[model samples]
Target: MNQQLPLLFPNAISLTIKREDLIHPFVSGNKFRKLKYNLLQAETQQYKTLLTFGGAFSNHIAAVAYAGKEKGFKTIGIIRGDELGSKISENPTLSFAENCGMQLEFISREEYRLKSELSFIENLKAKFGDFYLIPEGGTNALAIKGCQEILTPEDAEFDYICCSIGTGGTISGIINSALPHQKVLGFPALKGDFLKEEIRSFVNKENWELLTDYHFGGYGKVNEVLIGFINSFYQKNKIPLDPIYTGKMVFGVIDLIQKNFFPAQSKILLIHTGGIQGIQGMNMKLRNKKLPIIEIND
Candidate 1:
């Protein structure tokens, strides 16, 4: 669904949001897109188990857990923090994944970074037997393929296409399918330009750029300002945005608009790639800090 913003902008600019968040309840937005073909491929190969990696409050972990359960595959999540293993009851995301029957294995942060190494993978295969592996953030060739379908012929009229960048699969797909006249802008959740090369590896198009200014101190790090913005935005727009990705993207887009970063009369389409499951976890963190929680609809 394309929803127009209520606030009028200068230069006759119009802002619209592609509510990809509404695509599914548990496996919503980019998570749904990323997993679509991977699930089919797993079933095609008759794989009985799926193994993936994530952090404590990761949306990927939650989505993969539910996807595996619904698709009839045994799921295993290699979580980053070993300490989180003992605190599953205190963490909403981990608890949800656990509830979905995802076998959770906790590892040190250093070990987590070596997840892509051949030696580390051999260790996993030795322990878990044969299983289909989905990379962290679920980005792969098939994922990009599913994300390509996010834009349609009707979306060609937009001058700017904006979305939050994760593993770069979603934006790469959008860039590949975007109209020649449209520019795809990515707001990375991580605070780095290293994603440029990662995105370039998956796309041949030169129509996209990563906006690095709005990460709000990198992935999973949010202050009161961002929390306040997310709460207010949801209150006004009735759209629940997760703090890790969509919330930062929306905040950045609005801030850029106020700064006149876009030309007057430019039509903007923002992709609301869902990660709403993280809201409860984020709110928990906020409450621990005695800060205001995100205002989400019941």
Candidate 2:
């Protein structure tokens, strides 16, 4: 479930990556860590089906759908947005989830806002009884338990740990697992607008710091600079990084390094939270830009 990949710029300073992105094909990356316990709990409760909510291009939805299909559980994705009806190709995430055997239920944003209410759960249960419901990004206590296991095996002590922030589940788990001596930096994929307060509310750790500038545009948004950095990274390390999550976090980390935020000799570990399906959509959007395509040249 992990891989030891050397830092591309390693020198006197020690840098390592916890390659959780390579964990499983369907249950890939941080999503796998976050969902492991939830799945187990579902099985323990004898749940025959799983239901979750997310937006159009949510990595959580994709992971859950694929995992459910592979594990032989019925899955439903309560997606936020109107159904495009026969226009499935318009959104790659929706297309992939359907192909993976997930039942898609589209709802308006207004309906999605009532997601956490008991009334909503009761209504859903009345229609689809006894199904296990996993919150978006699997940010529950059980999920955190699975993510905590990610940091336990590392023998080398790091001065700092960095990871991209989505629902803050992974960062919360990392911060909770980190030693008192280590600092955790979260580069949020969402804008700083309310993310700082959101993360703080989740894990009230003294050593955690949220960097808001790296979000490029916003969630699922990218620009020329991010595309360029993603291209350069693959060229240098031959590691594929999707632009939405890990690429943005890596971009932020490099900028921090250049800013001398940490001493040159600082040992750091960065978590690669995979979102490879995100690349398919991003590539389609960037296809017209003539961005340096990361094709095998040899």
Candidate 3:
């Protein structure tokens, strides 16, 4: 469905959202896209086990776990932050993954940083005995190939395609599939322009740009302003957005509208890459900090 948000955009401009979040309850949006080809490749390779990495409340972790279970593949999640090992019961994402039969193994943050290194992967292969390894954020070539299917011929009507950036995989696909007349805009959930190089590595197109000023601190960081915007947007649009990714992108898109970033009468399509699963874990942090929690309908 193309959901228009006239209230959020300037009078002459049109803003609509592609509800990719509604694609599936668990493996929604880019997670589903990122995993589709990966899972198929694993099956083709006759790999019975799927292994990936993530943080305490990574959407990728939860998606991979459930996808593996549904596909009849044993799953393993190499989690960052060894402290999270004993606290799985307290984390909604980790707990959900565990409930889906994903084996949870926690390692130090330092070790997590070497996840892409050959030696670390070799160590994991030796320890786990040969599994299909999906990198954190699920941004491999197959993942990008899956994400490329997000935009269809119907989407050609839009002048701009906007999406939240996590590992740059989703936006890369959008950039690749976007019409030549459309400019794809990405709002990074993290604070940096480094993703430009990462995204460029995946696509041959130059029709996209990153909005770096709206991260609201960085990945996994949120404040009252962002929280309020998300809550209010949900109340108005009846569309719940996760604070980490979609919420920040929506916030930036609206702010840019107010700032006159787009030309008058521009048609914008915002890709709602799913991350709602992280809200429960994020709410836990908010409650602990005595901050306002993001409100979502049951």
* C-alpha root-mean-square deviation, candidate 3: 0.9
lDDT of 3 by residue, 1-298 (tens): 6788747456688888998999998999899999999999999999999999999999999999999999999999999999998998889999999999999999999999999999999999999999998989999899999999999999988999999999999998888888899999999999879999999899998898888999999999999999999999899889999999999998998889898888999998999998998999999999999999998975
Residue 147, model 1: Cα distance from true site in angstroms: 0.6
**TM-score list, all predictions:** 0.98, 0.90, 0.98
Candidate 1, lDDT over the whole model:
0.93
**Which ten-residue region of model 3 has the weakest summed lDDT?**
2-11
Lowest lDDT sum, 10 consecutive residues, model 1, at 4-13
lDDT by residue (124-174, candidate 2, tens digit) is 899877799999777888877787777865534788888998887888888
Tens-place lDDT digits, model 1, residues 251-290: 9888898999999899999999999988888888889999
lDDT of 1 at 38: 96
Error of 3 at 1 (Å): 2.8
Largest lDDT belongs to which candidate?
A: 1
**CA RMSD of all predictions:** 0.9, 2.7, 0.9
Please count the clashing residue pairs in each candidate, in the order shown.
0, 0, 0
